[model samples]
Target: MHIHKLPDDVLHGILQHSCYFQYPDFYKWKRLLLLLSICKRWRHLAIPLVYNRVYLSYYDQSEDTSIVDDEPVETIKGAKTKTNLDLFVINNCASLARYADIRILFTSNAFKGLNQTIERMKSVLKTWSGIKTLSLTLVNDVYFVEHQVTAELYDAAQINQLTKELYNLIPGILNLRLKGSRLDRTNKHLYGKLAGYYNNQLKQLSSRHAIGLSDNIYFAQISKLDILLNSENGYKLSQMCTTSLVHLNIRGVPVNYRWASFKTNNDVEQIVFPHLKTFNISYLSSTPSVDRTGTELYNNGRLKIHFPVLTKLHLWSPLGHCELLASAIFPEKMDTFDVLGSSKTMQVLSNMRIPQVKKLYLNVASTTSNIRHATLQLINKILENSPGSKKNKLIIHEDSIQIDPAVIEWSQLTLLHIGAQINMDIALKVIAKLPNVDELTFYNFVAENIPEEAFALKNTSGCHNKLEALNSSITKLMLGHNELGHSKDAVITVIKYLSVRLESLSLFGAQVAFDTDMSEFVNDYSHIYPNLTNVTFRLLTAKVL
Candidate 1:
């Protein structure tokens, strides 16, 4: 005797609970079909679920024809008449419409009962006003018409008419994606017409601006907007819109182009940027000459750009321009200014006057005296300006500047990034001299050069309150790639002598030898080097037991 099967509603609940929508392509229909094929009870529920996403255009006949007597195929007289998805949707119009979700797609062939397809969709489109989503796509195959007596001719107007009619019929569409195949026309008024239509729409909008759509988006709410700019129209388009834009990606803004010319008073007197947070200019080819020299000439030319509330600015170029932008656009309101470069932006950081900068990153490979001097001056200014401030922070890359032992002692530097292998000599010298240096980052330097007495330097085992305060106040300590290869014991012994106030450690590319006993080292080091969280190995492959 067979047990009674569950009802259709119960089966749907079971499927829905299992997150059937997530893996729609695989499980939605597969499981349903498999279960239904086993017995009639499951089939009834499975078939309807499978038919929910039916493509109305799929039933439309494939227009295939074998022209006779050298007659060209695709001609109205010679075209093959095939059943289309539209026809199938129309035949079962009432039943399919009642199911709530019906997708209709149209083909390029206007003669193949295409009008009949649109006629069938009117009821469904009208009745389903409460439909959560509606997507209408008009895809047309580009075909060139050729006759024996005349030159090649193509009729694209027919396809355009159908699309225009369908667009006008839909009153309230939440989500719309239109790929108008042959929308590009030589006529000038066409773009203005399209822009007017888009500006009046209430729904959220995004469209390709090549056909002059970028200059016309006046939508009330545009959270994410992306626009492409060329040398020809970058300034004009920018001057028109971009008042209330939040997130912007400005790519291909011609480097040699002149924006200063727009500084003229031929138009609005006030330079307008009411609200703009994130501004990223990736590609720049502009290289303003440095020879035109004076006080803040370099500063004004570079650092004097306008960004009232800009927190993050990513300029992908050499250090010179970066320095210029940072110094010019160094808003007193900015907190995090990250400079990622091929060489360090020491000069950029140095020349700029950033009084309110809390966190700073300078990632570059090469450095010069001008840049170094600029960096030193920048740091001096920050310390001078923010004497009693607690929130300001600085992080400089390896070998970016020459740190005079005296300068570190005189300034109010709480955090220091020394991207060099911690030598007993330098550590003794730095710790002894810098009374205010609380946090220190020892970057990867040649460990072989670190004199054996790095941690055991007796000239100054104990220094000022700041050096003594390091064990308590210091929060981060980054240890560069300085390995203790064959002599793991020596490395372990060295760490045992390190100050206890160290909080975080970043070991970039240092490897501990495989044959050594790490258990004793781990236990001893963990106890001595308390508050260690991140232990990273850059290019080492060894399982840690």
Candidate 2:
């Protein structure tokens, strides 16, 4: 059936699932282009979704850059007719924007022709249609254009000029997101001035300044707020626009009013955020600082907090232990719900009536046996609580823990990547415990006494039995971690272990078997891994040695 014939939600889901409106290169845009040519109804739906946002990245030369699409052999709205931007789309996927992100990253560099850029930019902006909101997420000093992405920090004056240029060119509303900055730490006015310049259209902001205070009127009606640095005026800023907030991220210890604190004068019906989508919070403490009053209020269910549209809630406490209090209400369906930490996080994960998490990551690092037991308990709990167990991609860091298969249902595990020396005995022992993992990626491997074969092809007697437990299940293997100065024997040894079963192998992290030609290496080892079809790598230079 034609996807457009489905209901709005269903059809939208199909387009999203197929990534029709995605960057098109490394995507299904050609089908979208075909639909645009033939299907009028499809065009009606797709035009809005396709050109909703334009990611024009000119990496090499931000100046003298009349951006051209390396793919999509057609032009749009005569904007592509002009020399500078006769075709207003570029094709490369440095990152992928999800369904809701209608962001067109056009900053610093204007789309000027080989001769005059500013006039060409205005002309393109004038012709381009259906782009109602131009949102930018400026995280760090990086801007993407064409095949290359470069980083060069800008000062106050430069920022002001760029803002003015964009504001002047595009007729639609401009919403800027200051996620991170490349501004010098000493330079104070740049963030404030840039934020304050277009505060009206700002929807999401990550700021450390004392916004919404008497000193500065830096509130741009932002709905998603990230408090990066703990400012003194954080309390007032969070309280300023409680009505329109869709997301709030608190990056420090959630103790005071700076931490999603929606309290009133004893109002039981005061639901803080009626339509918040996500709430990501982290703490730098093992013991989360909750005062006496806060605990008392939460215990009685007096503090009302509601998330009707929440899809994700990622809270990680890497520094120390963490414990989530009896929180408020959440919808039945959540895309990703992660609450990760050292020890306490594991306890919470194991005991709680867990939600249907789409992606679960567990990092348990402890040398003690009790913690290891708790880690295994958490793993078992995760498998039991989560629905559609296969779709749930579970990752746990068991650096020191030994998985005693008899105690737990280790057979339920399908994919395991323990954060430790990949070639070491512990990692193999754990992988050996989970016999169903179909794919594996190992990094930072030690060139110790790696067995010629992890598990004997004919069933051997010692640790060999545990090493290649994934031989039948594992088809794809990615070996990362650059031991650039080390010998290629590490790579050869590990590959030799899985050589019989592996169909594809990829090397990343700047070391390609000490710069040895992988084609020749594969050919030389052709007799071993007869099924190996593809091999890829990134060869590093001798300077890195």
Candidate 3:
């Protein structure tokens, strides 16, 4: 059947599927144009899909006199040289009017014609009456303009002017993201002029700096705000809070009490964010003495701030600082806590009471053997406090040591992922503990630590007896690493020892002869596991039976 002849609904569905979740780029736009040229009906059906999101950029070569006179070509790379974004948008204004999201990127070379470019962009934006999202990026080096004639000075002015123009053009923008840019004093003044203009429209805003959200702009409707703050601007958060803010992500900012200072005992003064649900703070560098002082103040009630509705807290800081923050701000409602730092961070959690955390992820970066042992003890302490009703999920990665079975509540865990190296004895002990584990994944496995006593049972009846004692309920098992010298025997022994009926088995980096090892295993497969049905081998050079 001809594609155009299909029902209109079907054709629309096909077009939607073709560009679903695709990044709007030059190639994607060209592909859509090709489809539009297929037939009039296809064009009519695909118009909305193509114009839903638009990407426009300005690449000025006026500084390069050699290329100023070159004719603009329509080729992929040549398109930038052949046409200015302003002219391109003017020509395709009809299509752009249907766009809901627009991304504009200005190259460093484009500073010469920035005013004209901004005017053109404003003209195009004026046509999109229903635009909801706008992303503006200025690619240039950082510099403050102080009566300078450098190219960067002009570039900064151009960016500031562009943002001002956009503020007037799209007052109802819901989602705005600005990158590789900074908002100068002039831009902040312009933003102040539009304070209440976006108070009810903007829902999410992200920027590289906090200056973009000057004191003038009210975030009454903003729910999510992501910003990268340096030490100089980090204190701005004390004034940026809104009652409606739910999620705030601050990265590359130094930790200090100034961020959430209180002036009085009133709720408004004590709690800047009344309904914040999630708070993510990542420090750029660790200052132990400073952090210690901050934590001490917070614990002693000198630095008081409240997050009544906060449930999910993610923290990435120095080794000792993370635990201090965790202890100071013990959110009773927190159900998920993710900590990323050295083993010392986990060690401090051993003494804390975090009973509400059901999903814990500890990304440790410890090399010393003593810290690893401390980390193990911390894990055990956390598991002991977790509620039995909650199905816990644990993920340990990056330089983590072998998990001791005594620390885990096997029946309470639903998912366990280990992305570190562990020997066969430890692996067996882990399996024996996870009696109710639904899925298990191991990144690197080593059988070199098998005890001589266990190896001596190779031809004895007691071998299977010891293996059968493991009470694993794992339905999916993934084995990774190929360091096992007795690869064939280890596979046989593991399958024989764990009496649980596995539904799926995957071998990663497995080295075994297909004809000799696999054939023998297949012959006894039904006797060993009558319920086993699926098997997969990945990164394995040896063939499978």
Each prediction's number of clashing residue pairs:
25, 10, 1
Global lDDT of each model? 0.40, 0.47, 0.53
Candidate 1 worst ten-residue window by lDDT:
184-193
What are the per-residue Cα lDDT tens digits for candidate 2 across 11-107? 6666555544323231343344454564666656555455434443222232224455674322332223222133343422111222212112233
**lDDT-superior candidate, 1 or 3:** 3
Reference-based TM-score of each model? 0.49, 0.54, 0.69
Number of the predicted model whose lDDT against the real structure is largest: 3
Error of 1 at 349 (Å): 5.2
- What TM-score does candidate 2 get on C-alpha atoms? 0.54
User: Which ranges of candidate 1 are over 4 A from the true structure?
Assistant: 1-242, 249-270, 278-317, 322-374, 386-424, 427-443, 449-476, 482-517, 524-545
List of clashing residue pairs for candidate 3: 72-82
- Candidate 3 lDDT over 1-545, as tens digits, reads 97657888988898888866634354455566566677788877776676656555545342223234444422222223223344336446434433333322333333333344445546555545555776654443223322232322434455556555656665557876655444433323223333335545778876664443444545667789776653433334434545778898877655443443222233422444577888887765655223333222245444445566777778776434552354344557576767676666766666666637656655555434677665666666666766642556666665457676776554566777776777767887787777777777776665466544444334444233332334555666555555446566665454333322343343322433332233333344444444433443332444321
Candidate maximizing TM-score: 3
The weakest ten consecutive residues by lDDT in model 2 span 93-102
lDDT score at residue 537, model 1, on the 0-100 scale: 28
